[model samples]
Target: MNLYKLGKFLCTVIFYPLYRIKVIGKENIPKDGPVIICSNHISNFDPPVVGITSDRNIYFMAKEELFKNKFFGGILKRVHAFPIKRGMRDRNALRQGLNVLKENHALGLFPEGTRQKNGEVGKGLAGAGFFALRSEATIVPCAIIGPYQKFKPLKVVYGEPIDMTSFRQEKASAQVVTDRIMEEIRQLHKNHR
Candidate 1:
């Protein structure tokens, strides 16, 4: 098996027993197509949990800092994660994200832009919105409940794809689209509560 799947298998072996992970709305995810899985950023473990929970191979848009350490960077690379400089509009990162969609692969990212460990839903960056509208890819809002710690009942809920197709023609700002995405995530988190 490829490193991505291998890593996922190993994670499942560990996550299943440790957290007793629960996933909802798997049926909402399209089996095949370019999709943007956007979720709230709570912890470093959030990405792996969100990615592995889905059946699709997820290519994550991780922060650039995660690549600074060679050893950890190698692991990130093996898991199909690319770096994105947070807090600024990084064109190259955006291009790479769009390319992932153009290739019809799943692109995973945190709309919140950075980790908010407290589990509070915060403002999201427009990157996910830009990718969805530009690539016409479906945006799947995911909500991860509970902490990433062992013995906690971690849950991940994948919401229905947010259709941004109609806004393609209009000049919708990134912030506006991001607001809508964050709202969906909040709703998912609320439903799980």
Candidate 2:
């Protein structure tokens, strides 16, 4: 198996029983075709747990700073994580994301753009909406419920695929679309932290 799948399998075997990770609404994930999985950022544990929400491998746009450490960066690369420079368009990252969608693969994005330290779902940045509108791929909203304390129960809730037809209109903007996506995420986790 490839590194990504192997690592995911290993994590699943270990994390599920250990942490009592609970997953809901996984049926919302498209069984095939391109998809963008938009989730609220909560912990460093977010990617691994959320990636396993579906059996398909998820390619993520990790921040560039995380790639600065050669050893850790190499592992991230091996596991299908690409670096994106935050606070800018980063055209190369955008193109790479589009290409992933073009290939009918699953792409994972944390719309909050970074991990939330306040333990509350925050506003999403424009990146997720930009890709959603550009690729018109299936957008599935997600929320991670956790204080991330070890050996504690954790949950990843997946919401229904967002309807983009209206948002596809000529007047829609990326930031506005992002706001809608974030709202869905917030509702999903409102009962949690």
- Once fitted onto the true fold, the runs of candidate 1 whose alpha carbons sit more than 4 angstroms away are none
**Cα error of candidate 2 at position 56, Å:** 1.6
- How would you encode candidate 2's per-residue C-alpha lDDT over 38-137 as one tens digit per residue? 9999788889988776777899999999999999999999998999999988999999999999999999999998789887999899998899889869
RMSD to native for every prediction?
1.2, 1.4
How much does candidate 2 score in TM-score?
A: 0.95
Predicted candidate 1 versus true structure: per-residue lDDT over 15-101, tens digit per residue: 888998999998888888898898988888887888789999999988899899999999898888988887788888888888889
Relative to the true structure, candidate 2 has a C-alpha RMSD (angstroms) of: 1.4
Considering only N, C-alpha and C atoms within 3 Å, which residue pairs clash in candidate 1? none
Give the Å error, residue 30, model 1: 0.8
- Model 2: residue 26 alpha-carbon error in angstroms: 0.4
